[model samples]
Target: MVANNTGPKIQQEKATVSVMIYLYCHQNHHTPRNQLCNECHDLLNYAMARLTMCRFGEHKTTCERCPKHCYRKDYKQKIKQVMRYAGPRMIIHHPIMAFRHIYKNLLSK
Candidate 1:
């Protein structure tokens, strides 16, 4: 996986994405803990691939702030839906990651 060659930042971003997707799947699809429905699983894989091939690599900003858009329009909308549902809940379900993401965004600005 490209994650093996990436820096800590990229790995952490991957973890955050994973958590978001998990939360989304769990709530929306009524998935079991630590499991994803088929559609969500596909989305997670797609998101990971996009992140792996990210042009900015370790120095990349959050997808929302990036100058270039890498995701296809449909997948982009799907991810946006996932993020919208999962973002606020991160503070409750995964506080540390949520705060770290917020902190990283603040520093990037």
Candidate 2:
């Protein structure tokens, strides 16, 4: 699916899963897919599910390991800091609360 150019430059899309898949395929090509154990499959599947991106065509998402900015439909918790940020971000959307949090955490004695 061609992505509708939403801004000045045709937004570049990338997927983390695609990268993982690429490596997975590369590695698997050497060591047949059938030989891959359940652990490997599960780990790869979960990683792919998060990093795969379809923001352009097919709307699939890619992995975050890639050096691109695509909406990752995968779990944010895959990274520790992302998980931590999401919680506080939701809990304190109010400007006043945000200010309080900043002062409390950063500037207080």
How close is each model in CA RMSD to the real structure? 2.3, 14.6
Q: Across residues 23-91, which tens digit of lDDT does each residue of candidate 1 receive?
A: 999999999989999999999999988888887888888887888998999999999999999999999
Cα lDDT of model 1 overall?
0.90
Q: Point to the candidate with the largest TM-score.
A: 1
Off by over 4 Å in 2: 1-35, 52-109
Q: In model 1, what are the clashing residue pairs, if there are any? A: none
Model 1 weakest lDDT span, ten residues long: 1-10
User: Candidate 2: lDDT of 92?
Assistant: 41
Instruction: Please report the candidate that would top lDDT against the real structure.
Output: 1
